[model samples]
Target: MSKRREIETLEIEKIVEKLCLKSNIILRADVLRALKKVCKNETKNPVAKKMLQLLVDNAKIAEKEKIAICQDTGLVTVFIEMGDKVIIRGGNIVDAVNKGVKEAYQKGYFRKSIVIDPIYRVNTGTNTPCIVHLDVVKGNKCKIIVMPKGFGSENKGRISMMNPTSSIETIEQFCVETVKIAGPDACPPYVIGIGLGGTMDFAALLSKRALLRPINLYNSSKHIAKMEKSLEKKINDLKIGIMGLGGISTVLGVNIETASTHIAGLPVAVSISCHALRSASAEI
Candidate 1:
């Protein structure tokens, strides 16, 4: 028989802190590659080419200075993978994760963007109460990923309780409409994430989770992968380009994630990220 593994809450918090700092400072490799790819593809559009290169350059400076790639710094989002055989000590998982975020913000001196109340509009100060999602899978180790999700592209997200009878083109059109609406405001050379199942809230959550996937990869489903490629082409064809400047490359990549849901309900959500798609992960 296999023995259960014990994981200290302190260990989780420390790793979370390090990941928060690291992700905010460093641009993910896949995102960087996409930016460079667009630089090459947008040779005809001088403005687009220059803007895309600037983004790549900005990433380099942020890494060297050990500062946030984007000033918004974003509301912290944590995704945790807890192994079924593991047990935690010291404190609860959610509290530990939030503690790590608080420590990281203090240590790194990142911006405090979170507000306790939507209407009151008071700063949380500590950047506590970050978004956390935990999952139990078959394993013995806990894995954590921290993503600093800026509100720029996040606000551009859209959701629809798609009719169960909707066609593929209908879904594709909704995703395209979202990008056109986002335009330059959300920042361009964007990474588009789509979630295609589950309930209203879950679909939105899945959409954000979809953004965590590397832009270079495709979903496991054959048809889904095809749809991603199709949706990407459709979005770029809009010529929203880099920051709505008009170029061959509008979106860097499109990723779609799906989950099972009730037969009577069909839901879809779209999430997006700017060129500075910042995230980092650690396994313990």
Candidate 2:
């Protein structure tokens, strides 16, 4: 039998709190590099180029000053990959994560954006009860990824159920139309995550998970990589520009994740993440 790895709940909480602070304040290096590259390449649209530059500058300032890149520090979303042989000690995992989130928001002075009730609408204040997705894998370690997702871009995400026979062209069109509809609301210079071939909820979750990938990486499948490139170009062609001001550098990247689905259904989801693109990961 494989040796079991025991992890203290406090250790998880410490890592989660650190991840929240780091992800919010420091934009991922890949994302910052992409924005700078866009600024350099967008020669025709000076306004958009300037906006892109500003974004880069903002990231630099946030990192240097140890402050959030955007005022909306965002709701916490944690993805946990647990090895089958790993054991949690000390306390419940979910409670530990929530405690970590509360500490991060309070100590780091991040905006508490969670609401206790969706309809009645009262602020959670502590940003507790973060969205957690747990997956069991084959290792003896735990890996955690934290994504601070702002609502502006998140609200624009969409999912659709299409016939299994739907062509790539149809899927491409749907993605483009989604971006067009999102427009400025999602904050241009977006990172688009496309999830395909899963159940409706799974598709949406996959799309959100796709955003956690590095901006520089492409889908591993050759066909999917090609489609990702094509989608990126099409999205930039929309001229949404920086903050939707009209330019050639609208989308920084397009990532696609796929899973097996029922023969009768082809569910697709598009998750739009703004330029902030804040996420960080660690393994323990």
Candidate 3:
């Protein structure tokens, strides 16, 4: 039998806590830089151009003050890639993740956005539990990524089951239309993540995961790459601008990931991410 390497659950918990605190409470440097670049690229509209600059300035202020970029911090989400050879010795994986979330939110002075109960709606004092997705892969090390999803863009995501006969153009149309309708509500200069195939729920999950891909990389398949580029151009053409005032910096990137699907339907999902795009990953 392969020896199971012991994993320290406390370390995992501590890491998660830090991730939670940093993700929402801090304006990540990468995302901040991206916004500045997009801002500098706009030349046509004065309002949008000014909004972009203001966003940059605001980010600077948040950094200096060590404050959250947005009031709606977000719900905690952790994605874990567990090693097959690892054995968690201290506690349950989910418990460790939850404890980490609680400590991080509390220590970082972030607002607890989680409500304990539905209908009655009581706030969970600390963001005790995160929405965790775990995958056990063939490896001896573990990787964790935490993403705090803001309500604005999360609310705008959509899923659809189209006839399997639906053409690629149809898929593109749905993506573009969804963003168009989202307008400024979902926030502009957004990252659009599209997941096609699988069942409806799986498609939505994949779309969310696709948002984790780096902004600079294009799809691997040439055909898919071209489609992504075309869709990106269309989204930018909407001229939603920095904060939807109208400019050339609306959509920063479009990403699509897929899996084989059933024969009768085309399962599609779109996840919209706002300008902040706060996320971070770590390996141990």
lDDT of 2 by residue, 1-284 (tens): 66899999999999999999999999999998998998999998887878889898999899998888998888888999999999999999988988988998888878988899999989989987799999999979999999999999999999999999999999999999999999888777999998998799999999998898887999999999999999999988898888777978789999999999998999999999998899998899
Best by lDDT: 2
lDDT of 3 by residue, 1-284 (tens): 55667789998998887777677656666567778888888877888889889888877777778787777678877899998998887889899999988887777677788888768888888865578899998877889999888889999999999999998899999999999889988778898889999999989988988888877678898887888899999999998877678878878889889889999999999999998887878888
Q: Which stretches of candidate 2 lie over 4 Å from their true place?
A: none
| Full ranking by lDDT | 2, 1, 3
lDDT for model 2, on a 0 to 1 scale?
Answer: 0.91
The candidate with the higher TM-score, 1 or 2, is 2
What is the TM-score of candidate 2?
A: 0.98
TM-score of 3: 0.94
Models ranked on TM-score? 2, 1, 3
Clashing pairs in 3: 189-250
Each model's lDDT comes to: 0.90, 0.91, 0.85
Model 3: lDDT equals 0.85
TM-scores of the candidates in the order shown = 0.97, 0.98, 0.94
* Runs of candidate 1 exceeding 4 Å displacement: none
The candidate maximizing TM-score is 2
